[model samples]
Target: MKYAILTADEPFISLAELKSLLNNENNIYYFSGIAVFSGDYKNIARRSSNIKAIGEVLAISNDPKDINEVIRGKCFTIKPNVILRSDKDRFNALYSTATKGVIFSKKCETLDLIFTDGIIIAGLREEERDSKSLLLHAKKPYSQSGTMDAYTSRLMVNLANPKKTVFDPFVGVGSILIESAWIGYTCLGADIDINMLEKTKYNLKYFGYTCDLLQSNIATNCIKKTDAIVTDPPYGKSVNAKTIKIEELYEKLFSISSEILSKNGRLVFATDAKYDWRDKIKEYNLSIIGIHFIYLHKSLSRAIYVVQKR
Candidate 1:
């Protein structure tokens, strides 16, 4: 079906992730703080002939009144193709005259909304209640930004095809690992910090995941051959060791990942440091597939690199 995946502000990064997830000819729309019509969205449609642009901006809001205002006067010709509710906003309600006055209330907040034929059809929400069921909650830590919201994680995991085992070397809190396990893949997680490793174990246990958890440095760890490696390395600002420099860390990561990653296997990770990771990837004989920039905070922009064994 022809559809678009909507992303929030600092969309460069989110758009990258969305592109990885969608991985198709559909349109991708971006906005700043949730407004319908933005220049970026139009650009996306223009750049990708497969996509069509339609502007109807909405933000993640808890206030019912604010949500009502966001959609109250907004025109809907046939209800909506989909209505995605994010965890940040829980007031999910949809109306369509063609469906005999149908209304739906999803369990989680919506992060992405998809509409078609002037009716809400798809709504992406945070999987807080049965978060364990959501594949994204697997190896993610409990930290605010370390974890992917249930909706996005689910979408990514669904898009990813894991023929062999999946490994996360920098599994902070095991969010990605847990998600991989939930999706019926044998997964492994490794972290240098014992404390973070313990936390990952605790969170995985809490979520009832029994994946392999190891304590080892990514640079020197003995990793198994695997299908893919997906991770969110330390941003080098708050979580990483204060003593080590970011450049040194990247060098170590390149050396270790190149040694352990299997041929044809993919490596996907995000980093805020603007060091030339492309050069490092080439040095390691890895083929660069894509690089996406995601905005985490106001000033921090993370570059998510996707590469494969050469």
Candidate 2:
């Protein structure tokens, strides 16, 4: 069994991302902030933005015998969770269970156990998220007023379930492309403005990456096939779409994506919550897999849509 301790913020998006990347979705159980599921734990953890820690589940049972079997003769520590936080008696009982043939010290602990949903889950933490690297959006070599943040960029790419290649039609400063390349994908980016393409190139080069860059419009039909199309198109006054309206741009994107994307390929993009593209999506024979909303403030909310070609 595998386990993932997810971040508490916007957990629905985290769940959607985990579900998209992992198989055997039916068996996945989420309790509190932890997710118990079956998949490639290392692959999912490396690409994940919301998963804090992931590893194998050694023991999962309410009975102390099950817990004792794993903790005995091992140096471990018990991490507090929602259950133990509110119930002191439960924490004491758990501490007593770990003291049997076990040396418990915070500094000397080699393994960790978390009690949640009336059960103790003990495991060897294989990977922990790099909090500093995930917040390095501002430190990029090139950035503009409206460049997407690193966390959201990685989340959008993961929602696409990308295999080998990821394409971003409106690759402003290569936000999506940067995250995709970092996650071991062949990145391809295109934008109508030559200046923006140059900025993307400079930023990607700073990170020691070289991706295929093109100066073209979103309506272009000559682009090569890609496994996933992940982008954040021009939106609001911060971005200027000179040639076509935003609605028309999405329609063209949906139309072109249906033709160029590989079989069952995903087109993951973000737009304002006010815009409705269901009609356009249907007209292009695409299927809507998921839509997650992130509220910016009282007046604005961003809608992320995950659509796949049939």
Candidate 3:
């Protein structure tokens, strides 16, 4: 079906994540903050919170009479498709008459009107944006260094789209795992710090999420293969101590990752792009499919890499 999507401020990252989740590029079109595509985007409402809404296009406005013509019909549904009004005076004038027999409410419904550059598309609501309640719960119970925003974690995990199980090799306080479970994926969290693991358990139970958590450093543990991996490792430009270690740290790291990550399995992880990750992934035959640069501030920026084992 043809659908229009409203995206967030940092649309590039969210759009990339959405495209990866859709696993399609054809029939997908981009606008200022909207994406028009023909495919199964129904699952999108369930997957990511970044997408504001998805709907079928009913009507578009280019001619002056479009709004007047729609108003003339005078038949609106009980669960009416809202007017995603772009012009204030025009909407107020329409509102004065449109609600003459139509019901209106403040709550969110499934379908509504979308106005893109004076074009009006009427869409049946597929999914309202996922709630941030779970994210809020996660933040309240845990405090740590370099905490990824709940939304970013959700977007990253959605890109992975792990089925059966999702693993976080460097699951610090299990923030990513919480987002995974929110999207209905069984999660396993591993961290070298036992204290962090214990904290993860605390946070998980606080949110009533049952997760398999262990304290195993990636450098030492022989990890059993997992369906997918999404992690944000706490590290500097490089973990090397003397003049930056020569691929030793990442070689060992990706070696273990290759052992644990299943064939064709998806992985999403974050890192400073200046590291030796490319060489390390080359050794393990892992290929990066999507990479987005996230700007944190003037001095610091990071890259999120989406990977698949070849």
Q: Tens-digit lDDT track for model 1 on 1-310?
A: 2224334333444344336434442454343322232223223332221122333345333333444444443333322323333421222243222223223345323334443323332222211123334443533446555465454443333323346677878877777776676666788888888888888788778777777888887666667477777777776555556677667777777776677777766777777746568877788878887775646677776666778787
Question: Of the pair 1 and 2, which is ahead by TM-score?
Answer: 2
Stretches of candidate 3 exceeding 4 Å from the true structure: 2-4, 64-112, 117-119, 237-247
Q: How many residue pairs clash (N, CA or C atoms closer than 3 angstroms) in each of the candidate models, in the order given?
A: 38, 0, 4
lDDT of each: 0.54, 0.81, 0.68
Q: In terms of lDDT, which candidate is stronger, 2 or 3? A: 2
Q: TM-scores for all candidates?
A: 0.59, 0.90, 0.80
Q: Can you tell me which runs of candidate 2 are displaced by over 4 Å?
A: 63-65, 77-79, 83-93, 96-100, 105-110, 239-243
Q: Total clashes, candidate 2?
A: 0
Q: Residue 116 lDDT in model 3?
A: 45
Tens-digit lDDT string for candidate 2 (203-223): 898888779999998878757
Report residue 67 deviation for candidate 3 (angstroms): 6.7
Candidate 2, residue 138: the lDDT equals 49
Q: Decide which is better by lDDT, 1 or 3.
A: 3
Of models 2 and 3, which has the larger TM-score?
2
Q: Would you give me the overall lDDT of model 1?
A: 0.54
